[model samples]
Target: RDIAPSDVLAAREAGATGVVLEAGATNSHALILARSLGLPAVIAVAGLLSSVTDGDLIEVDGNSGEITIGETVPASAPVAAGRATPSATRSSAPPVTRTTDGRVVRLYANVGQTADVGVALAAGAEGVGVVRTEFLFLDEPPSEQDQYEVYREMADRLAGKPLVIRTLDAGGDKPLPYLPVAPEANPYLGLRGLRLSLAHTEVFRTQLRAILRAAVHGRIMLMYPMVTNAEEIALANEQLLAARTELAASGEEAGDVAVGAMIEVPAAALRAEALARHAAFLSVGTNDLAQYTLAADRNNAAVSYLYSQTHPAVLRLIQATVTGAHRRGRPVAICGEVAGDVDALPLLIGLDVDELSVAPHSLERVRAAIASLSYPECVARTEAHLRDV
Candidate 1:
C-alpha cells in the first residue's frame, strides 16, 4: 500500500523504530520523510504484510533491505558482511565545501517541514534547497493565512538563508481530498505539478500569495514544479504577478522573490534554454526526469531497474539543462536523490551544477565527498560520459 508523508512523521512520533512498506518509490515523499527523520525504512518488500503475524518478532536491517523473522538474535551475533550498523550520531560537515581544484559547490537541504531546518543547519547546509509545500495540503488545502504562517515561520527560522519553496505539487501520487480529480490510467504522466496548478488557478493563486507574503520575513525563492515548457513558466509567472497585484491592492506589502522552474520532465529538459528565458533559475528534479526520460515508472518495481539517473540519456538531459540555463546567465541546481549520491558527486560537479540540494541527513556525507574531488578531473569525466550521447 502507498504511504503518505504525514504517515511517516506520525510513525516517528509514535515511537516506531523502523518502517517496512509493501510499495513505494525511492524518491517517494514518504521515503524522503523517513530519511529526513532518521528513521530506518525499507520499501517495496514483496508480501511484507502477509508473511508476518501480529505477534511475530521482526528484525529489519534497513541498510541491506533484510527482514528477519521468528528468531531472536544473540547479542554477539555477527553483523552481515558489507552491511554497516546504523548509528545515532551525526557527523558535522564544514560550513563550505570546495573541490580540490578550488571550485566551490553549494550544498543545501531538501526538507519537508520546518523542524527539518534545524537538522539541516546543524549538518552544514548552506540554505534550504526546497520546501515541499504539498505536505501542508495533504488532507485539505490549508487557508491562505495558515499557509502564510507556515512559510513565514520557515523563513524566519532560516534567518537570511535562501529558502527555495516549491509550490503545491498535487494531483499525481498526491491528490488533494477537497480538490476532486478525475482518475487517470497514468497519473504520473497526467495532470500534476504545474499542470495541476494551472488547472486550478484559485488554489495556485492562494499559494503564490502566501509565498509572496512570507518572503518579507527572509530570503525566499518561489519554484514551480513539473514545468514542461516556456509557456508553462510564463503562465505560472502570470499567476504570481496577479497575486502580487492583489496583495498591493489590499494595502498589503510583499517581499521580492525570485521565480524558478523545476525541470522534471524530459520535454522541459530538452527545452531548458527556452524555460530559462522566463525563469530566474532552473532546478533539475533528477528523480522524475530519469523516470520520464527512460519511460520507466519509479514507483513500479517491474521498471525500477530502468530508473537510473546516471544513464547516458538522463545525463544528456542534465547536461543540456545546465548548458541552457548557463547560456541565459541563470544558475542551475540539482535537487534530487541523485545529488546526495556520493558516487555521482564527480559527475554532478563535472556537469557544473551550481547547487546540490539533498536530504538533510546526506548533507554532511555529500559535502565531504565534494571536498575530496578535483573539479578538473570531474569535468573531464563528465565530458567522457557525454561523448557518445
Candidate 2:
C-alpha cells in the first residue's frame, strides 16, 4: 500500500464511482490520498464489512451506518439509505477553518470500549489510532482464555485495519484489586506502565502473549505505556521475548508484533530521540504529560484547570517530544484530551504532529478542521506558536 496514493488516483481516473476500505488505513495518509484522487470513500462501522462492490455505485451513509446498493431499492443487510457520501456532501465546497495559513491536517480517534468502534466510524474518523487493551483486563483479572476472547472480539470489530494494542497499563489510577500494588507517595510517578509490568512478571508476560496471539487475526501494533527510559522499553521487550519463547516451547504460534513506547513522563519525552531508536514508533500521552509538567493532579479538583493542554510549558514539552521522535525518522502520534480540542487542534497540526488521536465524538470536526489548512500554513503557525510558548 506504499503506492496506495497513486492506486487511489488511478481508480478515480479510471472512473470508479466510490471506494471501501478498512478503518485503520483511513488515517491521514489514506484520507489525503482519497481527496487527491477525488474518490469518495466509505469506512466500515465497528469494522463491519462494507457491502460496496466495484461497480455498485453505492451510497455510503456514514451517519446512519447505511450503504445503499443498486436496484430500484436499497439492500437491507449492512446497508441503509438517506446517507450522503463524504465527497458528495463536500462537492458544494464551503470555506473551512484551517491554520492561520492553509494546509490540510489529518485527525484520528483513540478507541477503548466495543461501542467506540462504531462511534468512531460514524464520527467520520479515518481510523482508530490507539486501543487501550487494559479495560479488557480490569473487569476481572482475565484468565488467559478470557484475554483471548476479548482480543478476538476487538480484532473482529477492527476488521483488517491497524489497531495499536497497548498492553495492560496497570496500577496507579487504574489499579486492579486482584493484582495488589503497594501504595506510593507519588502514585502517578510510581511503578506504572513498564515498571509495574516488569514487577508483575506473570501479568506482563500474559498480556504480551495475548497481544502477540491476537495479532494473527488483524493488523496490530504493540505499545508499552508509561515508558520512561530505554531500559524500561528493553525490559518490556525482554519479557515479550520470554513470552514468545514460552509460547514456542508450547508449540504455539505468534503473529507479527511491533514494540513501541508511550512518551508521557517528561523524562521519556526528553529522551524520545534515543528511545525511538529502540521503539518501532512513539505516541505521546499528553494528559499525563500535562499533569506531570504542571504539577497538577488530573483527578484533583483543586488544580485540575491547571492541567491545561494549551499551557506554554505543556505545548513546549509536546513539541520537544515530537521533534525528538521525528529526528530519529520515527512517526509519533498524540493520544490525549488535547487531540479533541477544537482550538488546540490547529496548534497541534502546526506542531507537525503525525497524528491526532482523539475521542470518537470529535472525529468529523477534527478532520474538517485539519482539512481546512495546508501543511505549510500549519508549519508556520506551529513555529510561531512554539516561539510564543
lDDT of 2: 0.68
Clashing pairs in 2: 67-80, 102-373, 102-374, 103-373, 103-374, 103-375, 104-373, 104-374, 105-370
lDDT against the true structure, per candidate, is 0.84, 0.68
The digit string of per-residue lDDT tens for model 1 on 1-389 reads 66877787676666566778888888776787677666677888889888876545567787798877766546565533221222313544566779987898988999887778877887778899899888756777788899999999888888899999999877776777756678899889898988988989998999899999999999999999999888888899899999999999998889999999999999888899999988999999998899899998877777888889888899899989999999999999999889989999899999999999988878778887898899989998988987877
lDDT (10s digit) by residue, model 2, range 1-389:
12244355455546554556544223323333343232456653343344443335456553354666664433443433222233313323332324445543445567655656665555555556777665544556677666766766767776776678887776666666556778799877887777877888897788778877888887778898888889888888889899889888998788888778888898888888999999988888887788888998765545655767677778787788888889989888888767867777667876777877776655666666666666676567667777765
**Can you give the lDDT of residue 54 in candidate 1?**
55
Query: Where in model 1 is the C-alpha error above 4 Å?
Result: 55-57, 70-92
